[model samples]
Target chain A: MPALPLDEAGKYVAGAYVVFVVLLAVYVAIMAAKLQRIERELRELARFAEQRNGERERERVTTDV
Target chain B: MYGKGLRTLSIATVAALAAALSLIFFYAPLDADQGFIQKIFYLHVPLSIVALLGFVAGGVYAILHLRSGERRWDAYSYVCIHLSVIFAVGVLITGSIWAKASWGHWWVWDEPTLVSFLIVFLLYATYYPFRYAIEDPERQARYASVFAVTAGAFVPLNFLAVRLAESLVHPRVFATTAGGLPGSMMLAFLVSIAAMALLWVTLVKLELTAKSASGQLKRLRRALDAPAPGAPSRVAPEV
Candidate 1:
């Protein structure tokens, strides 16, 4: 194959690099989504714990009365 | 603990990647024959090599998992294969681009190197579905490890077969008779490989950390008798 002119070859080279970067970006996006789900679940768990603690405290006050 | 040093590793990967890109574009001399188009080699070859190594590493972890009957090793094996498959996708796309630029075709079936790589990629691609097919967690993990070890062993044999095959289209840089890569090109290639390997390790650590956190959360839920939010994953082994 004949050597491609610099101007023409540049596009293909750029395209290859672009594809690599795009794949990395997509992977990052997926990871970010997973992290978000984890955070949401943690928040729910914390709220549940707080709710349970409040119920226990209310029961103690009624027994003292 | 899985996340320990993750920050340092991430910083190091970014630095190495920057150095590699600088060397590839500015330092490495252009190929006399392929010229600028050959730049893709630094990216494509390193990704392919690292991905192949990752598969092998996954197999090693699988062996450890089987011997110790530990779930952590299975998690490691899963992440290694997971990242490798992602890297494999990058390899195929970049390889196709390079092929088109050099040979005027996106794919050439006659080339053993290309076909063998595709075969390896396809084989690893089935891991997820094959793993999910088994309903029992213990059985699933055990069977997946066996699959990983078998596929991992096949990788090297496949590579060796391609190396021995006579091929006119693909360039063989490692052949001693071919005079190999020039010094500058070799330097760039080595650094690129290091960068990719570091990146792979960093991603694996990150994934394992996330899985660990999830596992801990499940433990907490069980201890507190909190209702589970959703069904557990059938494929991803608990860390």
Candidate 2:
């Protein structure tokens, strides 16, 4: 096939590159969301551990006193 | 462990990709046949190659999963397939754009390579539903591994069939090193392939790390007897 004129060909070339970049960006965004969820879960788990530790300490002090 | 070299991988990927783009635009000569539009070749072909290989890798991991009965291998297979599916979408879309630019149509029925690739993509597309359909985790992983291996085996056969179908008439400009291309074009092509491969590895590692984190979170919750956070993932096997 004969190549399209430079002006016309530019659009398709641009479109192809844009599609590639956009897809990569979308994948990165999805991963970012997953990372955010992981952070939240870690925070929740940390808080849960801290609460349990506090409760155990309180029980121990009460028994001693 | 998955994130161990992620930073270095990311840096190397960026460096390679930047070098590729520069070489593509500045170093590579305009094609006598396709001109600037041929630039798309650098992006499209590499992605196609990487995605195809990823499917095969997924199948390899699946085989390991089946042999060892290790859920981690299953997780690896799943992530590889998942990433490849995403890349496949880019392949089809970019390929369609290239086709439209070259042939004046968004799709062409007569092109064996294009058709074969589409077939491969369609075959892998069924993976999600297939996994979703089976409720048993162990059974699902086993069956999915089998499917991956079967599909992976089909890839090379499909390529061979396509080559045989149009070997003489349609010369493959896509395979840069196969003899026709100029040295500059070949260099850009190789660099692009390297970048795309690195990008694939980086993304796969990122995903596996994410899954590992999620799995650890689940383990923590179980240990603490903390009420389960939201519904568990139905399709994705936790590592």
Candidate 3:
């Protein structure tokens, strides 16, 4: 095969590299979404635990009274 | 534990990738045949090789899963195959681009190497549905491991078959008598492979760490008697 002119071949080379970069970006985006979900769940769980603790404290105060 | 040394690995991957890109563009001499287009060879070949090794690694993990009946092994196997499938996408897209630039066509079915790779990719593509089809978690994992192992074994055999076939289009780099690549090209190629392999390992670790965190949260939910915020994933094996 004859070598493509540098100007023409540059586009194909750039396209291939772009494809790679885009794939990596997509993967990173997916991982970010997962991290966000995990954070939201952690916050919810923390609030639930805090609310439970508050209720237990109120019950102990009433019993002491 | 999965996240341990992740930062170091990520740093190494970035450095290697930077060096590889520099070497490929600035240092490596242009090919006599393909010229600038041959640069794609560095990316396409490394991604393909690393992805193939990943599939084999997935099979090894599956073997461990079967022998030990351990869920962690299954999780490792799942991540391995998962990343490999993603990498395979890169391989196909880049391969097609290379083909179009070199052969004046986006695809050629006549090439054994290209067709065999597609076949392997198509077979692994079925893994997601095949895994989800089984409802029971234990059964799903066990069956998925079997699929991974079978497909993994097929990868090498397929490569061997392609290697033995008469090559009409695709350049057989390794089969060349004058040594596959010039020294500068070989150096760039080797660095690219290292970068890709490191990236693979780092991503695998990142994923496993995330899964571990999710698993821990599930354990906490159970202990606290709290409702789960959403439906559990049907396909992902837990850490």
True contacts kept of each: 0.76, 0.90, 0.82
Q: Evaluated on chain B only, what is the TM-score of candidate 1?
A: 0.98
Candidate 1, residues B64-176: lDDT per residue as tens digits? Answer: 99999898898899999999999999999999999999999999999999999999999999999999999988888999999999999999999989888878579876766
lDDT of 3 by residue, B55-167 (tens): 99999999999889999999999999999999999999999999999999999988899999999999989999999898888999899999889999999999989888987
RMSD of every candidate to native, in Å, equals 1.1, 1.8, 1.0
Comparing 2 and 3 on DockQ, the stronger one = 3
For model 3, the superposed segments whose C-alpha errors exceed 4 Å read none
Interface RMSD of each: 0.8, 1.0, 0.6
User: After best superposition, candidate 2 residue B67: deviation in angstroms?
Assistant: 1.0
TM-scores for chain B, in order? 0.98, 0.95, 0.97
lDDT of 3: 0.93
Off by over 4 Å in 1: B230-234
Judged by DockQ cut-offs, the docking class of candidate 3 is high
Error of 2 at B202 (Å): 0.6
- Poorest stretch of ten by lDDT in candidate 2 chain B: B166-175
Candidate 2 C-alpha lDDT tens digits along B1-239: 88999999999999999999999999999988888888998998899889999999999999999999999999999999999998999999988898888878898887788888999999999999999899999999999999999998998888779866844433485554556878899899999999999999999999999999988888888889997778667767877
